[model samples]
Target: MTDHAGTAATTLGISTAGLDLEASVALAAEADAAGVHAIWTSELYSMSATVSLAAMATGTRRCRLGSSILYGVGRTPLVLAAEARSLDKLSGGRLVLGLGNGTVRMLRDWHGTDPSAPAARMEELVTVVRKLWRIHEGRVHHDGHFYHVDITPTGDVRPPLRECIPVYLAGVNPRMIEVAGRVADGLVGHPLFTLRYLDEVVRPAITKGAGRMGRRAENIRITTMVIAAVDEDEEQARRDAASQIAFYASVKTYDRALAVAGFAAEARAIREAFARGDLEAMTAAVPDRMIDAIAVAGTPRQVRDALRRYEGTVDHVILYAPTLGLAAPRADRNVRRLVAIATAPRDGAR
Candidate 1:
């Protein structure tokens, strides 16, 4: 087990917004040079993560690049494996493949794919991708309902890269965590996780899943995502954070996570108020306690203190900076501030 307290080691990562691919690549290179450990690209309504990562791989020399959470059903497992292998080779084996079963809106409405039986589909996808990576020359066979692959490549389709590309599964549900424990190298906890849920629910479930494979809990790297906003004016920062929280809270997936975090009463009230167009109640429901439970908001010093509160609990804290309303210069400054605090010597070690 790696000691969480040693050196206060932390990985500084960022999820790029809807920006030009070329600009994003340059920003990634700049971030890498600024001592950022990893860079994660998302496949939202914009460019695909693979394409963005490919560009980033060419732009940066040392930083690890990966998809924050690529949908498992978004692409074929074989193709996904091939792309990951290719990116690994391109980036000199600094590629981490992060996979997850995305939201129903993305799967069904946007991508026009079936969302029924997602667990079965994800299981099959993980199996097929691993088989594709491990096997050399054979027709992979799976008797699963969602996936059945039996094709062999004529040429050299094997992943020649020797470095282990860590697969991090983004999961909040128990079954999904079990899948992660059984197959994935790491688990990315949801953004809505609270300290209580982490101790009582999430950690226990992860342990149970890992125990099934005769593996210790410490072997699995757990990365928790936290929405963060830092500014001199604390009230403005809280208001900014509330808008972002409201957006995710309205989503069913995150709403469930919030409820699990002991916010069921508040969540219900917020939902009811929102339905009735009560903006005041909606904003009021997102109190400082709720924001502090799942997010880090305040000045730079305060943000750093809040992060250190989870020092012994989580392995890595991926801070999601607010880039929605702020200008490029301001947002970049905030990002630099966060990176500085996150990578600084802990407890006045310096």
Candidate 2:
């Protein structure tokens, strides 16, 4: 609590994963009351991020609200723009519209959409959303390679609460991170990201893309998820965190996260085990070194120390509770522990 990290003031957030709708909203309210910097929701197969945030918007007055990611091709640009506008107004303009393109298999199988050029599709999608939000007149139309739109309102369209709502792009790879720099207000990094990767690869890509648009790199904020599995039983916490790391490592979509951190061999091990559907072996593949580098797990003191390592690399670090093997009660307990870790007293109190 005494600026042990000694870098900058930390802004902490919590993601409501592995929670039911009612429980997630309650957590949001609790996080808001506890003065967490932000409250984020990740969109998986269920639980609409926008919908959950809408309910959270009603209960929260202080915490900034967003999705860690809302998939790009899941909805049309107009629909996305409309949802952002609605949520922005609901939260009194505190919305950070975080978007992502689902993995190739997910895109094709789940959403029935093609993933031929996801980065390009995402860039175009952002462009269209911005243009649509700013348009106040009768006719609205866009003919893009991936999306097409033409709409003429019978009456004047209601002006958005803010013409420029902050859009945060989710990036695990350079191309997506670059798109974020070119257009997004912020970039959301994966839980597996390391400080070295952020400095050496992520930030530079942002600069390159920002340069293309004649914009400064520093203007784009960075928010990241830090998987935090807290339990008084230290061994249990480590196992839970490792399970999460193993699951992510198995996915080829997140290969860059491991590759950039020189965890390629470990990832291969996890992948092979994943193919055989051997959960235990996959979990076993994640070493303690990997856990220490990417997540915060163990006793309260140890978790806090691990979090300090991320202070300077991220503007907001969302405490991601590992849920692959956690029961509801234990997961909720971890969330509360995270809240305590985040709001603990620091020397540079402000």
Candidate 3:
């Protein structure tokens, strides 16, 4: 692993794009062998991330396995705690539990939950999950605006053998980042985060939350998953990235983040362009500034240089490669390319 200023260098991880489960596990094992630090499986419209990571743990010995994100509203806190503990044991204590307040649409449409009280519900869930994991026996109780859980630990229940599993809260909004710094072990900085946003919005919110608990800034891990694509034809890579940006521009949550990144007007334009099905206009609407702000796609060296801007601020960098719903061979090639870029030495330094 590369070292930076006596700190264990930040390492690369991959985000499984809810595609092929078997291929995801194999690719994770390949990454572990290639010296990548971690592999994160995500849940959107497929198999549970916990199940996927459990399978991945059995396949690899060294790499840490985690959930890139699991929606907080769908599962009860106790259930989530149990799953996290089980995965921790199965991975020999290498599980990172990542949670998120899912998009408003997901809550309203998919889970049939109330989006109005989501933030409060999410906070209550985190508190309950932490207490459940830490306490061996007792009735866990909380009086939040939404989701109050009161349950006694069964006599057969046992505490986790590990001290604490790292919990990452994924959010880009100011309030969410603040809560993450206050309650979670780490912050999963949103995919749309830019250096300006990190410096202006995230850092201040994280500091505010950390200060509330008398904690220091360094206590929280800041990690981000960037949309990435590396190819000989850089223009093709850019086009692929623009497609993703256009999709996100239509989403309300991402629109707010884009606004925070000083691209609100551009994002609005892109959204308008996308709705018209004018492919050229959609691509044109994604300005160079927007592309540089959210994604890292180009030649390998160019990608690395772009990533370096985030090195000191982010403790981990999860590369969200563009093979989410693709065929196995294509996805595997994407994974291999990411692994190569991440593990490659810079300036010929060993």
Q: Across residues 82-145, which tens digit of lDDT does each residue of candidate 1 receive? A: 8888888999988878887787677798778987867557767877888777546566766567
Candidate 1 local Cα displacement, residue 57, angstroms: 1.3
Highest lDDT against the true fold, candidate: 2
- Rank the candidate models, highest lDDT first: 2, 3, 1
Q: Model 3 — which ten-residue stretch has the worst lDDT?
A: 1-10
Task: List candidate 3 stretches off by more than 4 Å.
Answer: 1-8, 137-139, 324-331, 347-350
Root-mean-square deviation of every model: 2.7, 2.8, 2.7
Ranking by TM-score: 2, 3, 1
**Candidate 3, residue 270: CA error in Å?**
1.6
RMSD of 2: 2.8
Alpha-carbon deviation at 58 in model 1, angstroms: 1.4
lDDT (Cα) of model 2: 0.85
**At residue 204, what lDDT does model 1 achieve?**
74
**Candidate whose TM-score is highest:** 2
